[model samples]
Target: MEIRQLEYFVAVAEEGSFTRAAERVHVAQPGVSAQIRRLERELGHDLLDRSGRAVTVTAVGAAVLPLARAALGSVESARRTVEEMAGLVRGAVRVGMVVSCGVMDVPELLAAFHTSFPGVEITLTEANSDELVSSLVDGRLDLALIGYAGPAPDGLAVRVLADEPLVVAVTDADPWRARESVPLDELLERGVICLPPGTGLRGALDEACGTRRPRIAFEVSAPPMVITLARRGLGPAVLAASMVPPDLHAVRITDPVPSGALAFAWRAEGPHSPAARALIGLAENRVTAP
Candidate 1:
């Protein structure tokens, strides 16, 4: 029968009372009963046993109930799909970034997207690269600016934005300032202030050190804090070269300089909301910009 008739039939089957089903579907009891009767006639079966005080589904009705529900669900899903396509850039896009993003201009990129699609809401979050990658993988984040020590995280589509050497920061008073670069071992000898584990920089550092545990003086998330500590001579701060303060001497890691790779990543083969797609397009445009 018709979709409306099927809706009435399903409501009656679920509610077990014509009056209650009518109320649930916001239709008059007589109208609901008439529709169900029409549906039964069309299907050529006694769909409901209405002889008793409470209505009950017949054998045929029982078999048809699940199919009817599936039909309704499919219709609703199709309606939503059409609505989403029509309302481009209407939903929210959750974007993540590392604590210190030196490669991509997040604000500039977001501003451009917002300007193009004012209807789209851009929600920004800052976390370490590892955490950002995890969020993206779990669908908590639609897109992200993540840092990687080597290749990008698996199961994600990545566009490398920038690649730069990791450096050790020190104040002018520090003896290491005289040298242009220092070996990783020498830098770690005094004390190393680094981002905590589960971060891109720390991952790179861990990979480089390889079996040799460096003395970690302090673990902080903010790159500026690393510079602050290094300036105070608390320890040499391991940081992305771009993040090093201008006043601080940035010593390149000589023995196998660990490079920080920044990239834009998103789910490889998942359904991306219109807003998410719009933002991704903007990011791609930014990547190609001179």
Candidate 2:
């Protein structure tokens, strides 16, 4: 039997419905049935027991199911291998970055990648670290520059670009500006402008808080806004040590100081698109922390 017929048979066996199998294989239901009949004729045996409401595979069908799946998998693997050999010549890469990502120069990296693989189309999206990780898991993103706190995400290949302490920033007019460091309890006592929850920065802050809850004055997605509002004397801002403005007084968090980590990540398992593989290789070769 032809690969198409085998494919249809496998789909039917797995889906247990000719209509659903036809939809999955993008063929008409009648066509799928005809093909399966032809396959059964060639094999000289009935592959499925369709007398019941739910289709069941016959003994011979069960025996051939794994082989059919293996054949399809082999073909797919071969296609991916060839595509990867072509590098980023003809494919799209969906990339993600955390909002206000300043740990590494993402634009510069993208520019370099484009220069090298001019044929590859690149798309960029911005979101929180947690959202980015979720997108990666769901196959919506090919790669991401995400901020993570605590442990790295499960089933993701992570290359850390930056890991630094979280600091509290205040204006010169603030009473605690002269202090060398601030405790988590003391920092939470004042109005704090920080990154919203569901972000790596927020995770770190929350971990540091432990049982205590901080009064968040303003929850912003943009990192620069945190410093801007604090500098305006609105409230104290919590941000990465490196993100703290040069003019603002940055106080280290003394008790259980939280730290934010920025990383480049992709799916640890599964086949990567050609452009995704190329970009990942390029990033690995030329990752310099800012």
Candidate 3:
């Protein structure tokens, strides 16, 4: 019922033991147990099953955990918002991005942010688009620079930052290296190295290839690994135009003109903290100007 009680309950649910949860929350074991008992009493339901040494959440507990988490997150966001209103400008921004952003835009953007808002801490998480979207929905990320393919998620704001062409990179020894522009159909017949289906680049490539399924010779999760596979002459790797490594020859895909748009996304209805707003403004300015 209380925020502290919910915190204790969540800690116990996560740690699976009162003693461990107490240690994590920096409270005594008996105190933690008492809090959980009080919370269960208030709700008139048994939240945890403590029949064995390993504690487990009851059905009621499982049902309420997500709501408790959301409530706690809302509280924290409110506190941070208040702090930002005082012009303190000291808070953390969690950003979710794809690997290409790390290679192409992250360094410059981070450097500029650090210079402009030294008091603000920036945390970066790189993953496939699916993971990024999941994080964004869970309130784990403040903003995300993700590949835009289909419609944006409901109740989220999306701003298209850049449009990057998808290029086929092959090793110097490969037969396609001498070509100026490869036909989309011919490229589809040749094997292509790609990330797994959940990756943003993979989705864009799949959409672009249309009916002719490209022969995928390698499936790698890391961008560098895909580039390495291409460098080894295994197969041509599909990557954003900006991610082309210097050692590999980047061949433009022409027929259908395969390209992907990058966009920044954030929760649409929530109170925007000053630091978040500043980062969003900086991102839009950087992407739009010059």
Candidate 4:
């Protein structure tokens, strides 16, 4: 029969009174009664016991009640599914990235997502890895690309783009340049150029060094700047192996070498918008570690 007939029948069966069911369904009492009557006629069974003041359900109506509710639930679920997809046509997604998080091309990922969902707005934030992770945990960002060491932060779902060791990037004039790797003792003899404390590369270095503070000759946020200063022979720059310039020797740090990783993170339990979900799907294809 008609879906409306089923809806009216279910409403009356629950309310136990045609008057209350009409108010609940926003239909006139006569219309509610007529539809339920039609539904019963189709089934050739008395769906309600009108003899009772409370409008008790007939044996047939008792069995059909549960089935009618299930049908309504399925319809509502389908309607919601369509609305969620339609929502992707226009929405916004917030993204955060570490400074010089060049392990993956974030702009390229966003470009692809935009191409697919042109109406979706995107907001970008540039911060150190520590801050990016914090924003993700705080629900301020939908997704993030970051450089990190050791395990990922708790409560985030991560996709590791690249995992490699930290290195001592030194100019040829530096004595350590000739070596494939240098121990912490030799590397610590002088101040080293490094990213600021909040960065992942710096965090990795700090973890490796422990209580003995490594001398900081230069503290810069950008990896390119770290490379530029190291090229000028300021001091050895501690950087991820992948970020070391070809002009400089990438001497792996020894005496417990620290590793770094480039990764994408999102909330493990997400209230992700359709647009955000679409962007995450495109990120897998657009971002690749060198």
Candidate 5:
């Protein structure tokens, strides 16, 4: 019933261990367990089932967790609003970014935002487009830089930042290094090192290749790993043109120039904090390439 109780519950639920949650929240383990017991008694239902050092949320816990999270978020937002009124632009902004965006846009955006608002705390998480979208919807991220795909989330606003063309990255010693541009069909036959599903660029490549089915020799999750694998002559990788590492050479896909847009998205219904607004402004202005 108390805000503190909800906080403890959420911490335990997320960490899945009472000891870990206590460590994270800087509380004694026994204190955390006592609080949880008190909370369950007040709610008249068990929230978590602990067995053999593993914990799982009970049905009632699953039902209440989201509501508890929302309540805590609201409380934090209110505190932030008051702090803002006192000329203190201090609040955490959680950002979810695709790997390509992390390489291409995040550094500049972070620099600009930090320079402009030093007091605002920033937390960045790198994830694929699908993970970013899901995190944004679940209130884990304040905003996300993701690849443009189908319809936006029902109540979210999206701003397209850049359209990054797809390119084939290969080792300098590879035979494809001699080519200025390569056909999409030819590249497919040459084998492609692709990112696993859920990445924005991977989805774009899939759409572009259609039924041709590029031979995937290896699947990598990180952009740098993909480049490293390609550099070792594992195979060519499909990636945003801007994400090609300096050491690697990239060839344009000429037959069908596949590309995807990078976008900044946030909840349309929620009030935008000053820090969030400032970050968005920076992303819009600084994301353009020279």
Candidate 6:
């Protein structure tokens, strides 16, 4: 009967679980159940079969599903049209960021955008660069701050935030601490600490090493943890130059400098929502690439 109840019905039917539908709509399970119950009462028919573990829609519900979706889409389109005419931006923006992102102040950028458009909802997700790229391509996310190496992925445009050489971080106790730079061969010979595969830093390292492989002494998911393990004398760590602290020495890896980039990426065609465009625009205004 109500718009939200129809939304709940559609979500529950698609997700096959009330819990999952609740999560997808950012609502409580009980509230979703109550709304659907109220709607079913008004309709005088069971919309969903809750007898099994996975919920399934009744024949009546299946018949109404397409109509419900169309109605929701129409409402959204009308809202967007009115907002556009009034020169106001209000919508949801799904953003993804790579893990261990220390290159830029992302919080500041997000806060500024929120302050400017308080009505717009922002959902932020953290993932590795490769996963984030896939999410962007699939339209799961509107924008992403991702770390990458070599060429940009297809069907995406980027604003580079940090483009720096990947370096080996060593503690003072390590013999390589005094060195200005180390070659890929020496790094393979001595062994090195590294982030797991699929990370931008690791991608750069793999590209630089070519057919040759490095001796991976330890693998850590977090960049900070990689530095911590290396500092404890586990092994020299491979990471972005800027990630190395003053206490630890950064020895640039050469024989082709392995370079990693932190960038804000979106679809080549651009974002569907004004909120996403506004957020990226705000970031562009504030962020200065290093």
TM-scores for every candidate against the unseen true structure: 0.69, 0.71, 0.62, 0.86, 0.60, 0.70
lDDT of 3 by residue, 1-290 (tens): 78888899999999898988999889999998998899899899999999998999999999988988999999999987787754426766788887756533766787898898888888999888878877877778878887756567676787776677889998889998888788888888887898888777888888887776778989988788998888888988998888888999899998887777778888877666677777877876766621
Model 1 TM: 0.69
> What are the per-residue Cα lDDT tens digits for candidate 5 across 9-61?
99999999998999999999999999999999999999998875777789999
Best by lDDT: 2
Query: What range of 10 consecutive residues in model 5 has the weakest lDDT sum?
Result: 83-92
Worst 10 residues of 3 by lDDT: 83-92
Which ten residues in a row are the worst by lDDT in model 1?
Answer: 281-290
Q: Which stretches of candidate 6 lie over 4 Å from their true place?
A: 1-81, 85-90
Candidate number with the higher lDDT (1 or 3): 1
Report, for every candidate in turn, its global Cα lDDT versus the true structure.
Answer: 0.86, 0.88, 0.82, 0.87, 0.81, 0.86
Q: After superposition, how far is residue 232 of candidate 6 from its true place, in Å?
A: 0.3
Which pairs clash inside model 5? none
TM-score, cand. 3: 0.62
lDDT of 6 by residue, 1-290 (tens): 79999999999999999999999999999999999999999999999999999999999989989999999999899997787634335577888898878777777777877787778888989877889999999989988898888889899988898899999989989998789998777888987888888778888898888898888888888888998898898889988988998889999888888898889988888546667777777766765767
lDDT of 2 by residue, 1-290 (tens): 78899899999999999999999999999999999999999999999999999998999999989999999989889987886767668878999998887667888999998998888889999998889999999999999998888889988998888898998898889888899998887888887899998888998898888888989999988988888899899988999898887889998997778997889999999688778988998887776654
Best of the two (5, 6) by TM-score: 6
User: Clash number for model 6?
Assistant: 0
Error of 4 at 270 (Å): 2.2
| Highest-scoring model, TM-score | 4
- On a 0 to 1 TM-score scale, where does candidate 5 land against the true structure? 0.60
